[model samples]
Target: MSQANEKTDWLHALLLYGLGFLLFWEWLRPLSIISDTGQSEIFILFTAFLFLLSYFQLPFWLSFPVKGIAMVYALHEMFFPGSFFDFLWLNYFLSDFSQNVGFLFDGRFDSLSNVFRTFLFFILLWLISYLMQYWLIQTRRIFLFLLVTIVYISVIDTFTTYEADQAIIRIVIIGFILLGLLQILRIQEQEGVSFSKGRFPVYWLMPLVVVIAFSSLFGYIAPKAEPQWPDPVPFLKKTTGDDGEGKNGNGISKIGYGEDDSQLGGPFVMDDTSVFTAQIKDRGYWRVETKDVYTGKGWESSVRDRVMFEGSTETLFEDDVEVEAFDMKMNMTGNEEFDFIVHPGQVTSIETGKDVQLLENPLTGKVFTQNLGESVVLDNYNLEYESPTFSEKMLREASTEYPERLADTYLQLPETLPERVGALAEEITSEEDNPYDKARAIENYFVGNGFVYETTDVAVPGENDDYVDQFLFETQLGYCDNFSSSMTVLLRSLGIPARWVKGFTEGEFVAAAGDYREYEVTNNNAHSWVEAYFPEVGWVPFEPTRGFSNQADFVSDYSDDEASNTETSDPAQAEEEQAQQQEQLPQEEAASGSSSAPFEWSMWYTVVLIVIFLLLCYVVLKNYKKWLKRLIISKYKKRDDDKALSEAYFRLLWLLDLHGIKRGANQTLREYAVQVDQKLRTKDMKELTRRYEENYYRGKTNNDGWDEMKKLWENLIKKMQS
Candidate 1:
């Protein structure tokens, strides 16, 4: 009986420890997403170690030293570089600890080092582990902890990017199972009943498991209602006065075109919501606006000038330039409405099926639709434009004599621009003679260099740091904005007339519509590039972004010579062929980008093993009680007569409880026996209870009427089973 009680206690401790570890793990999982915490695995292992010590019910004298050693080892693995017993690390640790202790006394929490902060976190876990044990064992209650865990996950899910969908599901299941088990234990304690050979009452557990499983499945499969209230994120931002416009705030903005270009550098999450679609014969960049001034951090227009035009015929380029006039239709997706028209190339005319006036900003090249002196949103519009194709001969032969107004306007730069930027520009364009070659040299410099195209991890410039200088000299990592802005600044530093351009790329092709191809443009296609003004060439587009090809046409001098050898004489056919060739380049570049790095098979193997181990644990935990009960029953049946009689009486009590014939706490042995006899319609329980009392209280364990006692026990067990 004592051994069975000890085993039951061990099993209970193990269950408590497992549940505690799971709850603690939920807390650590979001740290990496919401903060800069690293080496989370070490923290998880340390938590498991602490819970294991609690499970063993170790003495404080022994457990304290073991836990201390484990914490020191974990800290060493996470932060230290030398051997485990290195004196240098110990000395550094002691010095840092002293400094942090002073900081604590001074209330200077922000000045704490990583090592000292980690030590405090370890102590926190230690206290939490002790509290969990106390709640599980002494009070047999964990509702407060479960409630806090739910709140923690929900708050992070609301404020941060941590998706708590699976976490919420796991918590609900674990919490229900834990509450049910704790309730059973509480009842057992109240009734002064030990668990039957360390096995839970399977009948009680089965209903709990079935209900939880069915409810979870139904909840997952049921259709959810759409949110009736407006999203709280924008409301929260508005209350905080963070419009996310310009340099007023440092928050991440949604991916789309905005009027403000004063702040450009920061991480942005991808928004795949469709903006609009275009139907055109040829693919081209959709120009929105241009910024002439580089303020060392971001782009902004120096002039807020507007020019009203009557008709759609607005000539933006000189007559000497070569351009082809084409027509395209723009259809808004209705997901969002805009007052401005997104056009390809210079606009000549617009047909909106309404008598609306057009507002054009000559300085910024942005056009807006107005009705009755108020901005109007259009659902569909037809536009005519001239797509310019520049010749390499004209670009190479164009003189450096710049127009006074153009140079002053497009070559604007901040006074705080770094000096190293000009030097690097010179070094890169030294081999080139003409402006076109010089621009190409700077544009192609980012291709094979150490620069990387990343969106999320890009760094925002510090107060003392120039944005272009940081990307070029320090980080060398960013997305389209970084590459395009750097190229514009680099050109300005070299006395070249350049401006920053923002718009959407030629979007993914959907299907062919009569004579044109339809393209769907989403927010993900929002892009930026560089436009440098050349003599007699106007402002030509150049794509400096890695993994992207320039969509503008650039004809080589030998193109006419090669055209005679090809069968396709139509200019549109040639243009389509060139577009197809340019499209394939980006795919090839992206594929070759990771070809040099070898795959890590060990990582895959480790992930597979972890998944398998978790599944096995789930299976064993679900059905282990039944297996344990059967083993214990078989062992009891094979015992000697003196021991068998005592074991049989205990089994009888377990069977009565399992069959809902439980004895009340106030009932004595005789009263409980009479009640059980009445329930089973037999007099055997009275005889069995008398024999058990004789052996249990009177110290008479001689097994002298063992055959009759066995017969009575068998009869009662058979009646209960029936």
Candidate 2:
């Protein structure tokens, strides 16, 4: 029996420590701090230290006093020192706290806010340890209940809210916690001091291991819960370039125009972090990167590493007889690690003033800088590209004779692509004869149709449905990715080679830096479009997404047969009409411009949580004695319901304690009640006391006297308040 009790005691202590650690896990995502940060480990180590002191059983007399001393020591070191009771007057702590509270209302996630929230998190974690210890000493199932909360927070932080690392270790911790809880349940269910040898064998843990193994396997294999609207509150944010020491990936790439690999219509939140500044001649599509292969889920570039350009100068689009030479000088100012921006037209040569290298992926036409170990300051570079000018005759003679090696890759479509997609493409382009006409027909279909463009509230395709099919037929509204990806799929269904392209649209031009016009390129300027591969012409950019112009001089005089009648008959006429269209953006749907919001209402959620926490603290402090009395009464009620009058007398003592009327335990019940009434300066509780004494001492049972006793209790309560 003693051994069994000893084992149970040890297990409960371990459970308390584990539960407190898990409570700290909730902050892992929100604080955006990892174990390696050394900041998060500070709190974790202190919490463990406090838990170690009370591992066997909390010394009720010393625990709170010890914690108070620790708090005083911490406060003195953090905010004040060499003074007693000066912390109450320390305006620095209060001012920062108040400012952070205001910032929460203003919807800002600043570092100061994180500091205040961390302080509150530590306090709440300490409370969890205290409560768990109390429950452990009583042999209650509360440890198991708290275990569920830990699991809930774990799932939210790791799977839903934040992409937490150390996944295997987290799973192992949870598995051990489950086994401990099960062992506790087993011990709790036993009847006698001894186990009767019916106790669970040590080998019973094999089943728990199996359960955890299968659970982890299923977690890996299962389709994630893609809610139509996921929980909108973000766990962490990439508001500034300096967040989390610049390590956290905010669902979007920090490397400007470098990569975007998320599924189409899958939601993400980005910040207004300034990625770069490009000096350009015009506000056209600034092509950064292109993707060749089209996966049913999204797009990728297997051909990216193939085309490498190390030389300083190279001519592009040499086969075309007629082209306009576009020469521009630019400087790289952002993301020193990555220096790549959209340069209009086919890049011919780059003349950098310093030692620099450019690697090109010919298949995708994506030029990336190899700035390995080189600090890329505002490195000045001059680039010249031949922007092809296509007339009706030039594009008409262009062939679909795609390179044999490239043909198979570009025309590739997932077998899962819906058959209706091909059929719909044929129907939309039925009036068109050539490939360019068909491509124009598809672009016109998107532009003329009543398809709305929205970034938020996007609905992802069903598990089995194709992304393009769902976008075209069911949800005919999306951002540049949706429009471009669907157009790419439709063009490919007809053997017209196309791929997804991503970069920035010509951003808001801010000022003239030296001789060039400088444009501020933010995350909002991140864009996606389509590149239709023409045999002699190579890959040409097309803005299938409405409200944006061509990135690679895509405006040709050759119009679709259906559009020729409605559109201008010449390039000069087309440019005039485009000017009118740009002016009409305000009157028409500016859906393209209103694509994304950098921040959301997530900070409001954090503020509300803090508000509720403060409210709870206020309640606890305001009625400390009443809460303590309720806790004691609950235990007594659980142990013996026949001692209702004794519970009532304990409540009276707590009430007297609240008024500072301390009565000795040797005082009679009548003496204590009288002292409590006199301290209150109101009606006495003499009859209530007499009835409670009769029921407690005489072992009297009266079912009818309960209502009169309740009346006396209410009167006493009112008298105390008065």
Candidate 1 has a TM-score of 0.52
- The C-alpha local distance difference test score for the whole of candidate 2 amounts to 0.59
Candidates' lDDT values, in order? 0.77, 0.59
What is the model-wide C-alpha lDDT for candidate 1?
0.77
TM-score of each: 0.52, 0.43
Q: Which candidate number has the best lDDT?
A: 1
Positional deviation of 654 in candidate 1, in angstroms? 58
- The residue-by-residue lDDT of candidate 1 on 196-303, one tens digit each, is 666656777779988998998888889999989887877987998877543435466566777787766877666667999999977888988888888887988887
Candidate 2 structure quality by residue, lDDT tens digits, 453-556: 54533456556767787778876756688899988899999988887878777766666544456667776677888877776666656667755555343333
